[model samples]
Target: MTDRTPGEPTGLDIALQWAELPPEHLKAALQALEPELARRHEMRMLQARLEAQGAEDRRSHLLYLSGLVGGFLIVVAMLTASVIVGINGLPWLSAMLAGPSVLSLAGLFVLRRVDSGTARQVARAHDAALGAAQPTPGAGVV
Candidate 1:
């Protein structure tokens, strides 16, 4: 029987308890245990994959949020510099600085919009790849 509780002996412990068994019986027990061991190994692999995906998703979300925040900060700093330059009587320089800020903000807005369509884009790309990989109906038929 398998262990079911924290204080209970583990499978290895139970196997060790059978160390005194006759050689034939020990070989038979090991053969019977093989399928359970393989199943447990598969379950652990699946759990690890799910956990890794969850962590990757969280890291990606954080990176996206950091990018948006960094973009906003850069725009704000550029506009502030533009205003300071204007007040100090450099009209052309102020306009030059402000132009890029506006462009940067627009870029950030477009990037934000693209995030919403990413899933559709990925699915479309996957479908396109699958379509390209399939052979044409008449190309190979004689």
Candidate 2:
């Protein structure tokens, strides 16, 4: 890391010194800087919030896809077991097959519902963030 001394003159300080402003002028400068700095910080916070929301949306989508794939695989397994039972004349496997298949399908249904809800929420958040970032007409223009 670069060495940074406390109370060192930064670029802004040097520029201010070059301008040779009085002490009261310096205080006025700081007052003028405050609102612009606060607005910049607010913009950064909004960006971070949008990023977090996008990440959550991606995670939710992945979970929904995995659940769908898993449920499909379970269904295939059930079908395979049914075929095996039919060929081998085994009656007990049928009961074993129904339970997990039903549970997996139910879980997939719930996951799909949740994923749809999350998609809507993500869309709303994206729209809101975009709206917030946009400059309004006749605002903030010198």
Candidate 3:
């Protein structure tokens, strides 16, 4: 005869539930899930690193574009300023515009360096994860 209690899990259910016990108890209770968990962790780390690389690339592209825009604006402004300088004679204003345009080029160079560094970090994480993979080619790492 079997008496049933509401909200009480079966023995199999209990065993399955025990599978999620934290790392310390995990070795004793359920070793099966460890490989799955490791794979999940690897995937998550890979995704995060890849996203960081992508963001860095986009930032670099934007900086380069901004620099190009600054250069183009300087050209147009210089043309107009030259006409004004010839007629009204204010050469200093044209020189001021040139300064900001040159400064933008420097800023773009710095941003590209930052972007490359961030991309390198992402690559390094990927390499680390790959190295971790070689040690546990089997299902059970332990």
Candidate 4:
């Protein structure tokens, strides 16, 4: 290996630096970056999405608890909407049947009211759910 200092370029390395590269060179550069960038971007997006999905029960993330409470309200709303729509027909009836959309939507709103840390917890919980899940039949177990 060639010993070099910082900010000092060797002849071969200097030749590789594309100060005057054509537009086509950009394609190669992008091609080299494509997979790595895609992976990095995907990971970042997943991180944000996870953060948005944290739990409300965490101590510092009590705001997420609002969503949990509102979830109960949403269920109530859907049941109420369904019962009302059962007497009616058309879109209203459809609304009753589809009221869970409202319930889940409300859940999302409640989730949104939470802090970023809690949202991250939600994502972690969700990810954990997707892993080798087993019944943890205890008072406080994963």
Candidate 5:
């Protein structure tokens, strides 16, 4: 590596400092920096795209988690109410309240499975869109 100090002027910095240079030489200097400028622009665009995608993923995950927690809380509340009713000598009403809790539990399980399946499908589609070859799930080493 060259013995460049931290305060060393780079090519662009040097180009900018030559404010009194002839027009043709200034044009040549700016043209020399064109490729680097284009690369930096493309990098910024790609980083912006990735940041947007990450934000969307975080928002979607938060919504899914909140819905799951809300469902669980509802189930817990129903069970608690059922137990309280049973303790108060209302066996028939307690059973009725408990019935919905069982159904809610089953619904939550199905929803979770469906959500996971959807996530897998989305990932597969993303890979496909990017021209990546994803191996079959169980077709790898034993």
Candidate 6:
């Protein structure tokens, strides 16, 4: 751990020192700081919201891409099985098609589930942040 002075400057103290204002200016300084601080807080919240939204979008896109690729591979496998059956026999055709079909279905199911769960989580986080940022009725009003 690092050592700190007993009277180390807090954020307000640092701001006051930087501004070279006297103690009598405390109230005015705080009044000025309020809106600036509120704006900074709002910016941070917006950034968080954007990040969450971006993550959800990426997950959705990934799920869609995976499904598309899986479907393509399954179709290719079916065509290959048909060709092999026509050339040699049906003995190995079922074995060749079964694996790809089962894997494609399972992958699609998993991707859908994961995407929905991530979406719900992001939505809940956004709602919670929005609710917290808004004041309750009659609050902070004289």
Among the numbered candidates, top TM-score falls to 2
Q: On residues 76-133, what C-alpha lDDT tens digit does candidate 2 reach at each position?
A: 7777786687467554454445433445454555455445565565556555544554
Error of 3 at 15 (Å): 4.8
lDDT of 6 at 111: 53
TM per prediction = 0.58, 0.60, 0.44, 0.29, 0.53, 0.49
Q: How much does each candidate deviate from the true structure in C-alpha RMSD?
A: 19.1, 24.1, 26.0, 21.0, 18.5, 25.0
- Give every collision pair in model 6: none
Give lDDT tens digits, candidate 1, residues 1-142: 2325678666677678677897787778778888877897888888889999999999988878887777777777878898998799776666655753345454564365444365555546555544554556999777
1-142, model 3: which lDDT tens digit per residue? 2233778665467567776786667455546655655776788888889999999999988978886677566566656665676466544544443334334434444443335565565556545544543445576755
lDDT of 6 by residue, 1-142 (tens): 2123578655567675746767657667777778866876788888889999999999998978877777667666676775676476454444444433444444455454435565565556555544554568999789
The whole-model lDDT of each prediction reads 0.69, 0.64, 0.58, 0.58, 0.68, 0.62
Q: Which ten residues in a row have the lowest lDDT in candidate 3?
A: 96-105
The TM-score, computed over Cα atoms with residue i paired to residue i, of candidate 4 is: 0.29
Q: How well does candidate 4 score on lDDT at residue 71? A: 74
What's the CA error at residue 54 for candidate 4, in Å?
18
Better of 2 and 3 by lDDT: 2
Model 5 TM-score?
A: 0.53
| Candidates arranged by lDDT, highest first | 1, 5, 2, 6, 3, 4
Summarize candidate 5's per-residue lDDT along 1-142 as a digit string, tens digits. 3334799777668787665788888888788778866886788888889999999999988878887777777777888998998799776666656653345453564365445565565555544533423335688778
